[model samples]
Target: MSDEKNDKDRRGIQSVEVGGQLLRALAHHGHPMALKDLARAAGMAPAKAHPYLVSFGKLGLIEQDPASGRYGLGPLALQLGLIALQQTDPVRIATPMIAELAQRLGLTIGIAVWGTRGPTFVRLEESPAAIHVNMRHGTVASLTDTASGRLFGAYRPADEVRALFEQERLLGKLERPRLAPGTPAAPAPTSWKEFERALAEVRRHGMSRTEGAVVDGISAMSAPVFDHAGAMVLAVTAIGPSGALDTQWDGPVAQALRECADRITQRLGGRPPVPVRRAA
Candidate 1:
C-alpha cells in the first residue's frame, strides 16, 4: 500500500513537496504553526510528519523558529509552490464533469466533501456560455439555506453537524452558503417539527430540491455520495437561478439525478445507510 501511495504521490506531488508547501504557509503567514496545524494543512498525520519537515529544515528548504518550535520556509520551500500549480490533476478530472453537467443542466454543478468543518468544496467547473451560475472551489459550503446544504445537513451525523456552529462565527446561520441576498430568510424554525420536516424531504428525495430558499428566483437539487467505507464522503449538486429549474422533481432530469447520486454512491463503494436512529 505504501509503495502504491508513493507511486501515486510521485505522479502528482510528493509529501516532501507538501511538507515544504506547509512550511511556506507558516512563513508567509508569519506564525508558529502547531504540529496539528501543519498536519491539517498538509493533509497528513502528525505522528508521521515532524521528521519529514525537520529534514527539509535541515536542508535549508525551511527553517524552524526556536522559540515556537514551528516550521517556516527557508527560501527553498517558497520557490517550489511558486513552481507547482502546473501539475495538479485532481482538478483536471473533476473539472470536465462539472463543466459537462453545467452545460447540460444549464446550472452550476459542484463536488464537495465533508471536511472536518462542513462541505469543503474540492472543485467547481462552470459552463462556457455567456450566462451561467458558479461557486468558488476550495471554499467551505453551507449547512443551511442552499439546496446542497440541506442534503449535507440531512445526511451528516447529528453529532458532527454541530461542528459547523462550534466556532460560532455564523451566529446560527449557514456560513458558506449565503442564503439568497434579498429573499426572505426562513425564520429559524423554532420547533423540531419544522427542522426535521425539511430534512425528511431531502433524505427521501435523494437530491435536495428547493425553491426560493437561496435567491427569490433560483432552484437546486443535490445528491449525497456514499463513500467506499460506507461513509458519505461528499455530495454533488446542480443549482441554477430562478427560471432554470422549475417543478421538475418528477421529471426525467430528476430521475437522472437520483441515478447519478446512487451511481456516485456505488462508485464510492456503499449504499446510503438505512436510517438508523429513531426520532428522539
Candidate 2:
C-alpha cells in the first residue's frame, strides 16, 4: 500500500495533464476556437484533442457553438471561476503588501472596495511620518472627488457608476473643494461627456490621481486590481501631504501603486486590462 501510494505521487496521471493544455489554450486565446485551431494551440493533433474536448463537454467545462462549430469555456467553467473568486479574500491578500508599501514609500496606503454606498476603504496602513488625513477603515469615498472613487468609476459598469455619481452630485458630493497649498487646481468634469473623458484618462494611464480634493493638503494616487474576468475588484491607493507626495502620472509613487496593484491582481489569478489607446 505504501509503495503504491508512493508510485502514484511520483507519476501522476499523464493523460489528464495533457488534456489541461486544451483548457489552457482556450483561456489564453480568450475566445471561441475552431477544433483544429484549438488543437494546434494545445500542441496536439486534432484527433488527440477531440477526445478530451468531448469529455470536457460532457463535464460542462467546455461548450461547442453549434452554428460556428467553435469551442469556448462553458457554464461549469464560469461557475468554478466565480466560486473561486467568491472565496478569495482580496483584502487579506493585499494587507501585508500595502503595509510594506506604506513603510517603503513613507505614505499612507489604503485598500478600497465597492461598498453599498460607494468606494469604501477597508484597510489602511499609515506611514510613520504620515500627516493627518481624514480616512480610515469603513470610510466611504466620493466618486468624483477621490482617487479611489475615480478608479472605481473608471472600471465599474457605466450605468451603475452614473447612478451613484448623480446621487452623489444631488447630495453635493461632486463639488471640488479649494486646492491645498501649492497644489495645482485641475478642473473637475462638469458634464457627463467631460466625466467620461476623465475616466478614459484613468483607464489610459492605468491609475487615478487626486490633489487635495478629498482632504486639505493631502494628495493621492490609486491603481485598480482586477479579477480573472477582467473586472475590477479592489483599488489600492497611496496618500501623502501635497508636497511630500509626487502626483505625476508616471512618477515613482504612481509606479509603485500600479506595480502593487498588478501584483495583487496577479496573486488572485487575475489579468490587468489592456491599456486604452488614443485614436489614431
Candidate 3:
C-alpha cells in the first residue's frame, strides 16, 4: 500500500511539471503556434506532446484552429485569468499608491470599478488641501458627465457602453429635470459618428478629463486599469478644485494618473495596449 501511494504521488508531480512546461512554452511565444513548434519549444517529442495537447484541449486550456492546425490559449484560460484578476483586491493594491500620489501631487485620488450602476468609487485618498467634492466609496459616476465614466466607456466594449448610455438616458427622461438650476448641460452628440469620434480621442490619449461636469467647482482626470486579457478592470482618477486640477489630457497630473493605472495593471498581470505609431 505504501509503495503504491508513493508511486501515485510521483506520477502526480510529474504530470503537473509536464503540464507547466507546455503552458510556459505557449506563454513565452505569446501567439498561436503549430504543434511541431510548440513541442520543440517545450523540449518534448511531437508524439509525447500530442497526448498532453489533447488533454489540455479537452479541459479548455488550449484550442486548435481547425483550418490552420495552430494552437492557442482558449476560453478557459481567459476565464481563469479574469477570475484571478477579480480575486485580486484592487482597492488594497491601489490604496497605498494612490495615497502616495495624493501627497506628492496634492490632489484627491480615487479608484473606481465597473459597478452594477456605473463606475463606482472603491477607494479614495484625499490630500491635505483637497476640495470638498461630493464623492465617496460606492458613489456611482455619471456615464456621460464624468472623467471616470468616460474612461470606462472609452476602454470597455462598445455594446456595454451603449447599453449604459441608453439606461442613463431612460432614467434621465423619467426623472423630469436632469440638470440642476444654475448648471449648464453638455451638448448632446449630434450623431453616432460624433460620439465615436470623441471616444476615439479618449482612447488615443489613454485618459480622460472633465471640468466641473460632475460637481460645480470640481475637475477630474482618469486613466484605465486593464487585466491580462486587455479588459478594463478599473479606473484611476484624480479630482480637485477646477483651478488646481490640470484638465489638460497631456499635463503632469494626467501622466501621473496614467502611470499609476499602469502600475496597478502590472500587479494584476495585465499589459496595456500598445500605441500605434503613424508612418511618416
RMSD of each: 14.4, 6.1, 8.6
User: After best superposition, candidate 3 residue 221: deviation in angstroms?
Assistant: 0.4
Predicted candidate 1 versus true structure: per-residue lDDT over 87-148, tens digit per residue = 33333434555566677776667777777657777776564543333357766655666666
Q: List runs of model 1 lying over 4 Å from the truth.
A: 1-95, 129-134, 162-172, 176-189
TM-score of 1: 0.57
Best prediction by lDDT: 2
- Candidate 2 or 1, higher TM-score: 2
Q: Which candidate wins on TM-score? A: 2
Q: Which residue runs does candidate 2 get wrong by more than 4 Å?
A: 1-83, 174-189, 273-280
Residue 239 lDDT in candidate 3: 85
TM-score of every prediction relative to native: 0.57, 0.67, 0.64
lDDT of 3 at 162: 78
RMSD of 3: 8.6
Question: In order, how many clashes per candidate?
Answer: 4, 0, 0
lDDT, each prediction: 0.63, 0.86, 0.79
- Clashing pairs in model 3, backbone N/Cα/C closer than 3 A: none
